[model samples]
Target: MPLNNIPADRSYTDEHEWIMISPGQTSVPTSPVRVGITSVAAAALGELVFLDLPEVGSEIEAGRTCGEVESTKTVSDLYPPVSGEVTSLNQAAIDDPSLVTQDPYGSGWLFEVQPTQLGTLLTAQEYAEKNGA
Candidate 1:
């Protein structure tokens, strides 16, 4: 799964988060972005133990802890790639954390956002290159 990563095309954060911008989607292009953790993050966490998602309509700041994950007996905070309002959380992921280990980019996605800023993230290729993947 790591070899064929379906990386977010938009940008990422140094904290290992990914953001996908959806333009012409009936909302402000930069406001409501989709956010998730990088595959690197999932791999580091090993088998997921638990997940906590933000309530819908909550405002989140970039680099701030919005949620958390418990894996391998350790808890890690989930960071936002960009500032935004959470529009939706991945209910499926909340139900099953193991999916994060199986498909970090697909079924493991954490939440969707209405980004307040999209310029503050790194590109998918850039993030992979930075992490030496």
Candidate 2:
């Protein structure tokens, strides 16, 4: 993938998760951040088979395992980019876990979190640079 194609607006983790501040009813300074597996991660995981998601309103801590994602090759923990309450989870992805590999940065989002602390994450450029993009 082209390094330039990495969405400039979001932050990424080495674990292959992408997180962006969701544009809430307000300006989203303190609103939830949408969480999802990155295309790189999705591609590496192969076809997704199942997604174990957390319930809405679940208090999750930053950098902790909030759920699990089972793929054709392996089962990986879904980590939160930031610590906060889970506002919502994508039922569509739950029903069709393959959506995670289909559109990793879009409708395949895992959950929305109202962050209490932004964990150690990297910007798109930073991630690209770190990964030799």
Query: Which structure among the candidates has the greatest TM-score?
Result: 2
Off by over 4 Å in 1: 1-8, 22-31
Give me the overall lDDT of model 1.
0.73
Q: What lDDT would each prediction earn against the true structure?
A: 0.73, 0.81
> Lowest-lDDT window of 10 residues in candidate 2?
21-30
What are the models' TM-scores? 0.83, 0.87
lDDT of 1 at 68: 90
Model 2 off-target regions past 4 Å?
Answer: 1-4, 22-28
Give the winner by lDDT.
2
Per-residue error (Å), model 1, residue 4: 6.7
Q: Per-residue lDDT tens digits of candidate 2, residues 1-133?
A: 3355577778887777888852121233477778998877888799999999889999987678989999989999988877889998999999999998899888999999888777778877777787665
Candidate 1 residue-wise lDDT, 1-133, digit = tens: 2323735455667787766653212233644556677778888888897988788999888777888988986898988866668898888888988987787767777889886654456656667788876
